[model samples]
Target: MGDLEIVKRAIAGDDESFLLVMQVNKEGLYRTAFAFLRNEHDALEAMQEVIYRAYKNMHKVKEPSYVKTWLTRIMMNYCQDQLKKKKRFTINETLNEISIDDGTVQLELQEALKKLSEQEQQLVYMKYFQDTKIKDIAVMENIPEGTVKSRLHKILKTLRQHLTEKGEMDHV
Candidate 1:
């Protein structure tokens, strides 16, 4: 069966379909959580919370075709809330424990991304890290496709300027 049929069943409160949908999307969801939370424990926590949230909100889904995007948005929102809660307690310490898998260039790019506003960061993460289509992002954000493209252009310009100023890049 196609994603649409599975998503419909899931939304219709079929337990098996819900579990199957979660199973198929788990890896991508975890990766997104890890990218935001920056640790294995927190990512797993975020994943569990997302599963609960997805189950609770399954009926709210408007488009079965966008189930993955909808789940990703939930994960992102949960991770962002968790980050906010953490910031309230801890002094904003720099995260130095870069994953061994991440390259130096990736680290530099991450630093640049940190300079962006939360909305901009989400836009970048969805478009680049998750490889979400521009139309999908537009749908998720309730913006026009042209606006998504324009914002991305501006975000890339800002990132290029930041890297250039830091001597991480010789040219934009």
Candidate 2:
């Protein structure tokens, strides 16, 4: 069945349908969670939490077609919450371990991303990392399509400026 039909059945209290939904979206959900959490263990935990929350609030989903977006938003929220809690404890273990040894450009890009607001960061993640469409992002963020496009444009401008200022983009 399609995602919409599966979502409808899941919302109607079909446990198997719910599991199927989770099974189908698990990879995408984990990738999104890992993008935010930057750890396998934390990503797994966030996925579990998102599944629990989505199952509990399945009826709140207004459009079955956007179930993937809804689930992703939930995962993002949970990962953000975990980050906030980690901030309170001043945990350095996870943060220090999530280093990119591939290239300095990636490190510089991450630094630039950190300078963005949470919403901007999310937009970047959804657009680039998850390869989500602008319309889908708009629906997930509860904003208009034009608004999302404008915001994304501004965010890209800001990132480019930040990287240029830091002389990180000179090589490109």
Provide the clashing-pair count of each candidate structure.
Answer: 0, 0
TM-score of each: 0.90, 0.89
Q: Point to the candidate with the largest lDDT.
A: 1
Candidate 1, residues 1-172, lDDT tens digits: the string is 9878999999999989999999999999999998988889999999999999999999999889899989988998898888888889877553665665787677778889878988898899899989999999998789999999999999999999987787744554
Give the runs in model 2 whose Cα sits over 4 Å from its true position: 91-95, 168-172
- lDDT scores of the candidates, listed in order: 0.89, 0.84
Q: Which stretches of candidate 1 lie above 4 Å from their native place? A: 92-94, 100-103, 168-172
- Provide the RMSD of all predictions against the true structure, rounded to 1 decimal: 2.7, 2.6
How far residue 56's Cα lies from its native spot in candidate 1, in Å, is: 0.8
Q: Which numbered prediction scores highest in TM-score against the true structure?
A: 1
